[model samples]
Target: MSMEGFSKVFEMYEAFRELSLSRHSIREFRDTKVPQDMVDKILELAATAPYASGKKNWDIKVIDDTQTIQAIADSIEAYTTALAPKIREDFREGFIEYSQSFIAFKDAPLLLIPTFKVNYSLSLMVEDEAIKAWERDNYVKSIATLSMIIHQGAHALGLGSCYMTGAVIAQEQIKKIIKIKPRHDIAAIIPIGFKKER
Candidate 1:
């Protein structure tokens, strides 16, 4: 290759490399609305994530209603109320800070919950032990792969997101609010919006 050709190729490669590394987890967001088209594109790209047995076992629920958001916040507060005294104190200060961080979900325009269904069952028979182990490993790997793709796609679109696993811990409350099926479980709650300029 000529020197000029080599330099051009290197520049393009570096640009793409930087794009991949530039992706980050954004917690704070502005009050701007995230366009529906952009949201659709993020989910579409996230759907390209690989799956075991070529089965897509993931589902997403987008929550944007004011009533629903208030219900979720209430549920979280109620759940947190039962914590041990010491544990509660430890999280009290942090929880206040965290609460402020999530003000974007209510103040901004979008919030999403991603759910993963684990259909692979482990048999009790000794003969099925190896198969069960393989299935378990495959199930976890597939879910992790899906999350990475989804997060990366969101970042690429200039949208800010925070993966709230704590929200998933309130699965029962979330399920009730969202009316999810019995087989489905909350995986992560990703609050998305425009990043507030620092």
Candidate 2:
């Protein structure tokens, strides 16, 4: 191919690669809120992620209410505040920074919880212990994979988002607030919104 043609191809491929790499865990967001239809579109992409054994394993529990999200963020901030000092010195500083992120999440417009259904593991019906263990592990992996796809999809739509497992520290309280079933596994709490440019 000519240099001109090759350059076009290079730019085309680079555009796609750039989109994938540009995604960062957004901590701060703008006041604008995300609509449910937009979120549903992202969820569609997320649900396309591949899983081992073709076993369906997750459910996206999306929360958009400001009051509830604020409460959840408060719980995370308070918990992290109490725990940060007691953690190992190597992790102390990062933990403190992450706690601030939790506090910031209060302003986010959407929160998505990609949960691994615990009942899916039991329903796998594999009698062998080793295979069962592997299946259980992959179920969680599948959920993480789904969350990553959704995060990317959100970015593609000009929105910023962060997948935060640190917020899982408030899982029980969140579960009660969200009314998640007992058999659902909380993988991570994701916050999505318009990011304020630095």
Candidate 3:
């Protein structure tokens, strides 16, 4: 390769590294709304993630309604609250407190839920049940990779976002509120917006 080409490659690597290192999981966001075009760009970039068997068996659900966001947050808190009684008395309070952190996206202007649809896997042809189960998990790994790319894309677009799974606890309630298809399950929930001033 020419020296000029190598220099350009190095510059791209340096810029990517800087972007990766600078991103933080932003839990607090300002009230500013994220532009639809910006969100579309992030999703477009995330679509490049490699998936199993070269098939992308996932869909992203973007939520920007304030009432819906609040409803989802309330459902999560309610779900965790229900679990409190099942916990040991000593840890009960701590568990509830920790769960509160899960709803940090309640105020974010946008919420992104990546849903995964389980499809045919060659691993299922194997005789071992354990191996099949383990291989099925690769679907999740692919979605996770896509999600990370979404976060980086958001950061590059001058927005803040957080990757969260705690909201999965309220999947049942959330399903009722959202239009996600029955075949797909929630993989992760990402909240994006402008970062709140510290």
Candidate 4:
């Protein structure tokens, strides 16, 4: 292979390795605030990620208000507390740990909530049968594609993020507090900022 070809291959490998090693669930963040422009750029890049059937199911909400952040954290706590005994114990410990590791969204200066919009109706008919089943399958496929695309974009931006399913458990309350529409389902919550060294 020519020198140019070898250089391209090496560069690709290096980029891949860098993202693999650097992409981690970050629970700690520096006290500094992330620039709004940088956050917007990352979100724009994430939106460009491929989707199934050309449908974009992911909707992101960037929360920066301290009051709203506290509301979200409170809702998350309440939802987690109400889970079945066995499951609660298993997750409560980790939730507490995560809470301590990262400051509440208020303290962190940035919070990102990604939601998946469900796009199926029972009224549709396919060959005389209701199209609900097919619609659900397609919705799931689209959400999966959105997730991969968003996370990959985040990794490429040199910003560390942790996918919080805990936030999803309190989806309804979060939606109310964040003012997201009822049709949009929360998928993950990411609080992005500079990483804090252990």
Candidate 5:
């Protein structure tokens, strides 16, 4: 087809409005299974996400095993349950209540934990100490941008997902289970599954 003809035919795919509008932060999940192939396809789309210097020095730990998921979820709950009381009184009760469901990693069939190496080579290369903060911010932004890609990618594949940062709250304990070294920057724990039909 000609350029104009193609453009007219593909007008609906031009804008990302429908994708954006359809995606939501899903909390509840059905007992439906999300096969490894579908997860791999979504990861493939997520891998195409761009980063600084093409340095894709990020780890995407896919936890599908039920036992490991429960362990990680337990650690998250242990940490959050204790920490929730220290939060501002106005939000504490709600926060604790939410953690019951929020920290339950095993409930979802797929868990994607995205972490970036906490390498400061860029900061160290710069002579000015103040430049370190800029490097740090950029590193975080790089991984965060990739997380957005993964979230949208999952949605596109008819999978519901939640960006669960509770995993980071107990990063120390969860790292032992996930075998990740401490201090590696964990962006968020994403739980993917079919949304429970209401």
Candidate 6:
């Protein structure tokens, strides 16, 4: 390869390394709107991530509506509130505090829910329930891979995002609000927007 071409490749590698190392989860965001095109771009980049067993097996649900986002937040808050009492008295307060992070996406301009379909192609062939269950869950790993790509793609675009698992605690409520199919399951809730100035 020519020196110029090698230099360009090294520069790209350095940039990717910097992005990977510097990026951190963003819990708060400014009200500035995230354009649909930008959202589409991130997902486009995310689609390039490799899929397991040559099956895409995953999809993303985008929520940009303010009211609907708020409703999702309220549901999480209510569910956690009800769940608080079940915790030991000393731990209840801490649990409530921790639950707040689950709904941090309420303030962001866009929310992405990466979902995976249960694929039984490999699992169904197995007679052992244990192996079957493992194979079933393996399909779900695609969403996590997709989510990380989405995060890096957003970061490359100067946007901030958080990969949230806590929100999945209220997946049933979230599913009703988003009208997701029964076979689909929540992988993670990602909120994206411009970072709020400290």
Ranking by TM-score: 3, 6, 5, 2, 4, 1
lDDT of 4: 0.67
Better of 1 and 4 by lDDT: 1
Model 6 lDDT tens row, 11-77: 9999999999989999789989999899999989989987777788788888899899999999999
Put down candidate 1 lDDT per residue, 1-198, tens digits, no spaces.
999999999998897687678877776678677888988998887788898855677777777675787677677656655443446676677775554443334444577777766666554444586787786667656766767776777787888776667665557876777866568777766778888889
Superposed model 6: Cα runs more than 4 Å off: none
- Candidate 6 collision pairs: none
Q: TM-scores of all models?
A: 0.75, 0.77, 0.94, 0.75, 0.83, 0.93
RMSD of each: 4.1, 4.2, 1.5, 4.3, 2.9, 1.5
lDDT of each: 0.70, 0.81, 0.90, 0.67, 0.79, 0.89
Which candidate wins on TM-score? Answer: 3
- The TM-score between candidate 2 and the true structure equals 0.77
Q: Model 2 over residues 1-198: C-alpha lDDT tens digits? A: 999999999998997798898988897888787987889899889879997657676788888889998888777776788887899999899889766755556778888888876434544665677776776788888887888888888998999988888777777767766866568878888889999888
Candidate 4: tens digits of C-alpha lDDT, residues 13-110 = 99878877767776667777777877877777777767654567667788877677778888776665565344666776776666443234434557
Off by over 4 Å in 4: 1-6, 84-107, 121-123, 126-134, 137-141
Which should have the higher lDDT, number 1 or number 5? Answer: 5
Q: Kindly list the per-residue Cα lDDT of model 5 for residues 1-198, writing each as its tens digit.
A: 899989886875754668888889887788877988888988888888777645677878888877888888888878887897789999998988877765855688778888887567766776877777776666667777778888888888888898777667777788778865446777788989988899
Q: lDDT-based ranking, best first? A: 3, 6, 2, 5, 1, 4
Residue 47's C-alpha lDDT in candidate 3? 94
What C-alpha lDDT, on a 0 to 100 scale, does residue 47 get in candidate 6?
90
User: Better model by lDDT, 2 or 5?
Assistant: 2
Pairs with backbone N, CA or C atoms under 3 Å apart (clashes), candidate 5? none
TM-score of 3: 0.94
Number of clashes found in candidate 6: 0
Off by over 4 Å in 5: 1-9, 12-15, 84-95, 98-106, 125-130, 181-183
